[model samples]
Target: MPHHDGEQNGRGLSFAKRIYLPRTIGLSVGSVCVAVALYPLPWMHWIWAMLVMHAWVWPHLAYQRARRSSNPYKAELQNMLGDSFAGGIWVALMGFSALPSVAILAMMAMQNIAANGLRLLWQGLLANLLGAVLGFVLFTPQIQLASTPEEIYACLPLLVIYPAFIGWMGYKVALKLSEHKHVLSRLSRTDSLTGLINHGTWKDLLQVEFTRSQTLNRACCVALIDIDHFKTINDRYGHIVGDSVLKALSQALRDNIRASDLAGRYGGDELCVILPNTDLDLAVGILERLRQIVENQVDALLPELRISLSIGVAPYEQHIVDAASWLNEADKALYGAKSTGRNRVVSAPCTRADFQGLALGV
Candidate 1:
């Protein structure tokens, strides 16, 4: 069967620095405690060396291997498995002493779950079992089921502090991932150029707005607004100045519209708005005011640069069968406005009976 080790390539550096390092340190410290629990045995000196190597040296070696590997994620996962094996070896060295053995197993299980849930836990457990068998062949564990009070005390600090520390670390990781997810979601929906909603997100919202309008028999309006002579602006003043003009327009739209209104950049130079439960006349009045505000703002801010708007307003009619038809009607009005005068607002003349070709897109 295939396994889902914690080899998520996207988690690369953060996973190592935040999670793996701390786990290594915990395992190392806990190993020493288990080693000390086996105190003054004939093999205790060798066990001390092993503890130092596993605790002090192994973490750095694992980090280096993970960092240098072509697939860092996969390498880190392998390192975790190695950690389990090391843990098993220590458990046997302690003669399977109750306090320290249970501590090692619990801590290892916690680390596995934190890394990638249950699958990795099982894999780590298997590694532990195999390593235990190896340790039995090599050293022949004394199988001390009950621990002396001294051994129990030695195991206490690691058991208490390590879990608390790891728990705090887990909490921090959760918060960071949550924040990252929110940022990614916003980036996906927003236009980079203008801070308005992007084309695809706006279209998705339009469908929802269309459904609300249709099912409730509500009056809803869509306005398609285009920047007049944008090409001329770019030609005369260059793209940077053109960008300033778009930013200015975007700001104006943001300031003028209500929070309930949906404003988005449809494509280059063309911005659209969805006005729910509003009539054509009301929308026109609103757009006309917006037109004046935008023109005056641009004039006040950048007097040398002159720019204007052409806006089209179309009410969502009961006869309009689909989202495409609603958008088309508004688009037609925008074209009409552009044709009549560069700076004006026009309404779609009438709903069309010829909805065959376009209706399929609904």
Candidate 2:
């Protein structure tokens, strides 16, 4: 019988607030139905007074009681059970007249199930039964199954409006849950530091893109980017500054690339991008712009830092066997960029012979 987060210990105010308005509405409408049904009977004057207090005063008193309690969630649960007990007592007082009694029990059951599912529902039912039995034994209430037309009319608001309101509440909860699930899904696939697609997710997308490119005979390129002298930068000016450098590069890629381009943090001090519907020249241009942006903007943003990028880009070649070989070509070009000069973009053009040579480790 797990409850919602707001129902957890020390979250009393939230739990209390959630139940208060609904209780107020249900009890208020319910009071009308009970008063109408019992109007012709010669019940004690105090019974009428008790009905007035229960209808008008109880909702507010219950809210304050739960709000002030050590555990508002638990207190609210108790309050709901108390509501069920009182509902049963109302049924007995009305001589078990059909419409009002059914309205009270149905609303109670709905709330109970909504609060904590089947577990709380059964508890509420038992509480209702106990209250009815006690009322019958003490008061010797007359059993009148028939309801007057006026009494049926009085129960109508509770029957119609209350359930509709409860349905609306359930709908709101469902929407919140959907939003939470979407957030979680994105978080799982994203790099927390860079806010880009993570390595594994990006790799998965690369495979899918590879298949699509082969099927559609469309152009696509993959770029492997490394932060030039990243280790030296970290050694000179702590990890915090190093982190800023990575974020700067990531931001530059986001700002410069097309909407369809996918950028990801591949690993330490290295990032990758998947440029769909792009050729070698277009990919190089995109990376060059990103490189210039990082070089120019980073110093202004973080005065203590001056950053540069080394990028390797490889376009999809018909001869390339798989995504791994294509990525390897980009990796090789990236290595060439790093070996020759720090801030440069290198393109690896793979031919059938190059692919065969790579496969043969020649």
Candidate 3:
């Protein structure tokens, strides 16, 4: 495949490095096979020297060429195609001896397919066929399908080692992909600023907790929290300090809550929590403690600034229709807290008369 020079350079270098060891081992072992097959032939001494150079020297040359190229991946691909071409030439030089020739060509095909899938495999095959035709024309070698014991023995190492190398490479790629997938998944579900679960994910979890409470007849509470006078803080101290306030509040929530509690950033300067297996009184106690912790925070950078939370808690009720109703109750309680006094916690009322009294800020 074609690659742009700038983007592919580092990737190309990695590709070349990955290929280097396998190329060295495969060629070194393959040379033995070719040498054995050529034993009975009356080829010139230069042919023997060329075989030695191809086995011992060519892998290093290919690596150096790819490393120097601007597009290393493309360069490595060309080097691999060259490997196929050289294998074809060796097969022809060995007079088309069946076992060793088939071994070399099959391993080359396997390498190409593993590297870049079908496209590289087909390209390598074409290059190999062309090299075979050229070699046949140059040397006019006699075709010999039968393979001797010496040729088979020489082919053994290549067959055993190269496949294990390919398998290991595949495993490394898979492991790296899985790690990246987890990181991406976490990033998607978390708030970048507060490092808490984001708004949508928290809402999804609220529904899940609500369903569990309904099915298991368990106690749970939902809390909606907002920073008191957050807009004033942002205007007075700027967004940077405001962000610090939010982070500090989140830290307070994280530190004070049980491990089972789920906290999230609901929106700008607003947060939420799900307290599973907790009644209204316990939820109030937990959030009130969180509020005191945030209110007591002392920042060396912004000493004059103080932070407080307005929180509303709604306990799960059998009469609550769905997760949305429960969240709405918590939201109403939060509104009451902010409306009456900005730095207090308000619990949702059970009766309609109490709800009306809360709505009127009585």
Considering every candidate listed, which one attains the maximal lDDT? 3
Across 4-44, the per-residue lDDT of candidate 2 in tens digits comes to 55356446787688888888988898899999998998899
User: How much lDDT does each candidate structure score?
Assistant: 0.83, 0.88, 0.90
**Weakest 10 consecutive residues of candidate 1 by summed lDDT:** 351-360
- Residues 1-362 of candidate 3 have per-residue lDDT tens digits of 44455557877798899899889988888788899999899999999999999999999999999999877888899999999998889889999998998889998998899888999999999988988999999999988889999888888887888788878888898999899999999999999999999999999999999999999989999999999999999999899888988888888889999999999999999999999999999999999999998888888977888888899999999999999999999988887787666799999864445656865867
Pairs of colliding residues, candidate 3: 12-73
Ranking by lDDT: 3, 2, 1
lDDT of each residue in 87-169, candidate 1, tens digit only: 88878877888888888888988888888789989999999998888998899977777888878787888888788888898
Between candidates 2 and 3, name the one with more favorable lDDT: 3
Instruction: Work out how many backbone clashes candidate 3 has.
Output: 1
The local distance difference test score of model 1 is 0.83
> Once superposed on the true structure, which residue ranges of model 1 sit more than 4 Å away at CA?
1-11, 28-36, 39-79, 116-123, 126-130, 147-174, 298-302, 348-362
